[model samples]
Target: MWLVSFLGKTITAAIAAAVPSCIGPLSENIVYPFKVSDNVRALVLTTSALAAIQADVQEKVENAELQGLVQNNQVKQWLDQVEMVRGELDDIKNRYEKRLRCLGDRSFNCWSNYWISKDAKKKSTEVQELRDRGKFEEVAIQITPQVQEFSVGSDVVPQEEADLQEILRYIDNDEYDIIGIWGMGGVGKTRLLRRIHNHCKRSSDFDVLFVTASRECSVEKLQEELCDEHGFGRGTGVVSQARIISNYLGNRNFLVLLDDLWDQIDLQRVGIPFPLGLVNQFKRKVVLTTRLVSVCGLMEVKKSLKVVGLDPEHAFRLFKEKVGNETIHSHPLISSLAIDVVKELNGLPLALITIGRSMYGKRDPREWEDAIDLLKRSRLNEIETTPEEEKIYYKLKFSFDSLESAELQNCFLACSLWPEDFPIYKIKLIECWMGLGLLCAFDAQNIYNPGYTLIGKLLSACLLEEEGSDFVKMHDVMRDMALWLVHTVGIQGINGLCKRGLELIKCYTREVVGFMQSGRHYLQAKN
Candidate 1:
């Protein structure tokens, strides 16, 4: 029976091997049954084989379903994470883009999506030739154009006359190596220095004459000037050039005008070398003009000058020169007013010159009075009417416009409310300012002790005139200008006061009506 069963099983296997389509049921029933010997064993083997096959098939199907679910979830999760990362990256890109834009308009290329290789080098000759002949040559050869160069004037001036005189005396005494002239703008400083330069040049006190140090003045320019003045070789390098010039000037007496000197300039830095210990080796006199007095002080000169305004007589002469002689007599009434006008000018040469130039050729008394009236009415605006007036207008405007803070401008305009030539007591001015609520937002320190600070800013800027120890005054013209600015700019300092007055009137009216109503109510109650 075992031999017969084995033979049957071998036949079933052969048939299944011949055709796989028949293997499932053949292996499940025929061959599988034959492999078992006893009835019970055969039955158990067949049932167990069928059951194992079904279980294997079911497990494979379940595994396939589970794998599909896992893959779907993984894709969804990965997509969500990718979206989050993408959002973060976008936000970072936007922030940097805004920052780059704020840097300048030239940064627009960063916004355009483009790729530039970090290690890119100039193309080889052959590759460049090919690129030049290619269709993309136009795009490849595109380049940004250079910006246009602009010319600007030097915004520097000379020192005052008193300062000039002091400098002159120092030169005469030969006490110092260099004399420096320094002061702020509109102080007639540059004019004074020029005058000194012209005077000294004519005197023949020095053998060689040269003026250098202009706007953007460089070592090369100085070297060139020095070389040209002494007829030396115009060498290329700064050190070589300067050394050549220094050697030539060593034994010669020279007057060098280093005009418009900036702060913290070292002669050695410009490549000009003199012997270490020789105090007056060349007697090379250098006159420097600068806005900073500290530069002059730093040079440790024997004499320093601080330029100030002219005296009354000099100011009068300066004014008359501007007005011209023909008009001086024809406009006697105007000329009579001229003395008062000069007084109002407060000895400023620029102011006098500007006012006189504005009144030039106009001999009409009415025109003079009108000009004066305009000056009284609106200081800056009146000056704007004529080209001559424009100069004084700009000078005053610099003082007025230099105020950076709006609160400061308000404080300045509030000053215009007072009568012309009125002497302002510091305490009283503070009280008025406080009453007007100007001090509400300011710090306690500024509110309580703004005397020196406020006056100093105004005085230095030439906005307010200092009257004695504790008083302040404004120029009549400046006062009118302030008033005009207040009205035009609609400054809240004066407007706020007017608004408060209106509010108080409204409140009083409301109180009176309420009182009348109460009286009526009392009469009704009594009846």
Candidate 2:
């Protein structure tokens, strides 16, 4: 043991004499020129002994100033910083493992869930790109659209504004679950409902749905519309549809507007939860528009509002807007005649706008004079061969007559086959035209172009109004005109068709021998 100690001391002294004090910097080996061997072991031992000897010699010759310069308060601070960085690194490693586990865990079924996979991939790509660009201080934000904006302009009747406020108050006061808007045809009930719907949509508190319940409204259709709105998929039966509606609306704040309801809609059948009060769920309200005041009682509307004519001042303003300002400003004489024409309309919104637009760009006072006389004749039921015509029907006829072609006229009239206030899908309308041979084909154009062009013209003329993206509708009064034209005014030679059943068979495409036999049996039974 003493010989080993003496050898170690002698080796340490020889190394200390050979190397300079800066030998501490050469401890890292740049190359491993030697493999494992006895010489390697001896060299490592000698290097360790030299380090110990150097420490002992520094302790014996230590300068207090040099030691103070080497380490002061900074040593403790450096240690604290090192500990904090180590803790942060450990925290980062732990979070990385947790995230990996979250993605890989089998219990949550993350692999099968499309939304989960989509989110994970999307976030992973986003984080990688962000780290690539070194955008640590900023993060990407994604926004989703839930509420729709109301598209009505500022120019509105103060009455409509008042009506809107009253309607909101009705819901706010919790006064009723359903409200009714009743008006004469073309008196702007639909427009009023649109304004109210816009208000509900702008506020993010409720789920708002607007359904047009035309004369052909059915429980199944209402359910289908509601289901489509809720994205519940096509349910099998009425019961299933109702269940879907209840699930979608039972826990949410919602408003449903049934536009142009011709009759009482079965709320329960359509899955609108009634008797509005509930223990914990949000509020639901229903608003409907109709031409019949009795529909209010049928629908059990707790509050009823009548959409009356616009006041004279608003009516004239609306008329001027329909006619260009340039036309009205061309002459003071025309402006005075325009007021007289609008006054003749008696504040009826539809008639005023239609007539005024028809008179647009006519600077002649004589044309305005002619319109006033015509409007008076129509309103008094004198212009028609029949005496029972409504004023709006004639005014709408005037809009119809302004169309560019007779083909357009035929198209507008063809829409009458659809039920009154019923929405006519553009595609279905074209099919109806082709089935009836109403569309005239040209070589260069496709077969449906004529019908589509006519539809656009009608929509621009306001003879046909859009209900939703896919459908268009004739105003109820316009539909009335169509029914009158087809069934009443054009019914001259159709009464004797029963006597000429054989001739009817010739025009019919398919054989109906069963029908002829049934007729023979009915005749014999009657005899």
Candidate 3:
């Protein structure tokens, strides 16, 4: 053994002396070339494992985004590094492939083989490190410091600011669990709820979920919306969905915002751990916005707030702002004309914004004068309504009439056929419009463009509200106006169709039976 070691040392010294600078490469050439194939194999295996983990992380990210959760910054950086490593691996593979071919029992370029093997071994180590790093316990996080800034401007009406503060105080009070915000349609109840949602996100430690309840609010529909937001699938029944929702929410502190609730939705039935006080030592609360004061009582709200319309001064300021300073300054009389318009609108937020937008660039005094005249006529024409309701509906009609085309008007009016606060599916509404011949198609294939275009026009006019990409909704007051236009004004096209359809389908009232009777009478007369 000593003789063999002495011979090995003598050979190594002779080689180092032959070329001192080549010693490093000569040793690596002997050591690494034999391991070249093994290193390449290990690299491929490590990369495959990494790819599998990357796919899992990507899927988790996509699911989290669907639930409105943001990914953690470290997770995002690791994903970026994974992509970069993939590019580097590709380069390494290409360089290895370009190496000189090996002949039987000998390499054509030993140095090339040695370098390629060395690079593969190093990259395999790095790839394995990345694989281990990718094993995260939590990949995504809830939106942090969740307060999103709303640009309501510095001129927020004092009443609204006060209302928001009062509501926040109620929210802080543990005794008030179910808080209700009730007001006339377009009086800013929904806006107040949104502000409260933002406030909860900022100040509170609870997980905040803001949802718009259906107009025909049902426990099942509410459950479905909540389930969708939480990435929960629709279960076998409401009971199952509720159980899943209850289990998930029961684990955390939660604040739920339910907007535009027209009727009472049972909190417990929708999967909320109600009376929230019993929630496993965690805090939970429900805040809702509704048009009906009775709904507040029906929901057993601890405290209910009435969101009143803006005062006259704030109303005029809001109108002028929406009308633009340029238009208001165009003629000295335009501002006064705007004040007249505001008076016609009755300090209602929706009417003010809609009418003001419609009058945005009208520099002509006659245009303002004409708008005022038509608004008065619209108000005078309506009957069987309270003063406040009458003002909003008729003032909204001016915007409806200002729709650039008759098709746009009909399309806007058609939305009112569904139940109040119901999200009318866009495709279904367009199909109905096409069936009614409201959309004149150049060809069968070309039909959808006109339908979507008309819907877009109505949306721009604020006559129709967007529920999501899939649905549009008509405000309750706007629907009432459409019905009024049909029954009282006798428009006789889509309007007539809406009234007849609503009576027959939505309401099993005397009007429906009367319509069938009238149809029989017409048939008898013809016979």
lDDT of 2 by residue, 1-527 (tens): 44543554465456555666576433212111111112223333443443454344333222221111121233334334434433443443343334332322221222323233333333334333322432122111211223355455677889888988988887665668888899888788888888888887876477788777777689998877654443443445887566556655666677888988888778887777766643265888888999898999998898999988889889999989989899999887998898888777777877776677677788887877887777667665445464323556666566666666665666666676555555677878886556445575774557777767888777766677776677787777777765555444341211111124344322111112223223341111100
Superposed on all Cα atoms, the candidates' RMSDs to the truth, in angstroms, are: 28.8, 22.7, 14.2
| Clashes per candidate (backbone, < 3 Å) | 7, 0, 0
Tell me which residue pairs clash in candidate 2: none
Local distance difference test scores for all models: 0.50, 0.61, 0.74
Ranking by lDDT: 3, 2, 1
Estimate candidate 1's alpha-carbon lDDT, on a 0 to 1 scale.
Answer: 0.50
lDDT winner between 1 and 3, please give it.
3
**lDDT agreement of model 2 with the native:** 0.61
Per-residue lDDT tens digits for candidate 1, residues 1-527, read 44544565576578567756646654444333322223222333333443454344434433332221111333334334434433443443454345333433223242231211000111122223322332221111111112122111232223244565676777766556677666543446556666666666557545434444643456666666555444454344776555545554555566566655655555664534443222465456766766567778775554566556667777777778777888888855877877766766666665765566655676888876766655555454543355433334534543454475766666676665555445676666666555555545367656657645665765655567666667777655566556544444433433233232235322222232233234331111100
In model 1, pairs of residues that clash are: 157-190, 158-189, 158-190, 159-189, 160-307, 163-305, 379-481
Q: Positional deviation of 149 in candidate 1, in angstroms? A: 34
Cα-based lDDT at residue 247, candidate 2: 52
Candidate with best lDDT: 3
lDDT of 1 at 391: 38
